[model samples]
Target: MMRAELAQNFRQLELKKKLEPMLPVLDFIAWSLLKHNQDVVSQLWVLSKQQSWRTSKSIPNSLWNWICSAVDEVTLDPMTKHAWLLLSDD
Candidate 1:
């Protein structure tokens, strides 16, 4: 159910051209992590380290707010707390 929802969200972002080319890959990583496919998730993380893009300002500010809200949600998850911590440390 969660994977489907995430995939739907990804599809919308892709259609809007609001996501990077690596986003589908990132979506896979997120879905895999949530599904306990750590090996695949780790591999995606490593691959992401090699990618770069020009950050754009045209993205809606509401999207940034939504990201913050999502991060807040993730922070409440025990399994995802580490990711939140790493984000905070940065």
Candidate 2:
């Protein structure tokens, strides 16, 4: 499913040497998050925090704003919309 596809994408990125020094940490975080079956918002939050900490700077507001914009562009079904609403409520 989505987890397998994401893992494959990560592997492809890694093979291109695009991840570099952050690869191990990013991979571990991604796998752990996927294993826990966390929601997309939660995963993004954790990844953003990790990226900020790894880079020794606060994550840019623009990055999160962009994520929001991207999410807004998706045409969610009823169940998905409900899930998104619940996440937004939190």
Candidate 3:
């Protein structure tokens, strides 16, 4: 059991090392999409990137979902919204 746990831990650490470098790029992409009023969590977009990640075998499935979810949860403050559109109910 100890050996199994040690192996699992080692594997997870290696995965972390591989995936850590990707976090900044992922975050930037998500931020840019959101800034441009695009959806980061869109199925169409997520599916498009799957092949590359799968080919590299770096990013796991759950990580993609989590990144999308994290990006999706971010809301642009109204104060920071562009000046082009005036918000009114009329």
Q: What tens digits encode model 2's per-residue C-alpha lDDT throughout 1-90?
A: 699999999899887776565655664555455645546755666676677645534444443444465464445455556543643322
Instruction: Give TM-scores for every candidate, taking all chains together and pairing residue i with residue i.
Output: 0.23, 0.21, 0.37
Against the unseen true structure, what C-alpha lDDT does each candidate score? 0.53, 0.57, 0.63
Say which prediction, candidate 1 or candidate 2, comes out ahead on TM-score. Answer: 1
- Kindly report the root-mean-square deviation of model 2 from the true structure over all alpha carbons: 17.0
Give the TM-score comparing model 2 with the true structure, all chains together. 0.21
Query: Tens digits of per-residue lDDT for model 3 on 1-90?
Result: 699999999999999999977865775576456654445445544576675454444555544555566554545566887999565543
Best-to-worst order by TM-score is 3, 1, 2
Q: Which candidate number maximizes TM-score?
A: 3
- lDDT-based ranking, best first? 3, 2, 1
Q: Judge candidate 3 at residue 5 and give its lDDT.
A: 100
In angstroms, give how far residue 67 of model 2 lies from its true place: 5.1
TM-score-best of 1 and 3: 3
Measured with C-alpha atoms, the lDDT of residue 47 in candidate 3 is 74
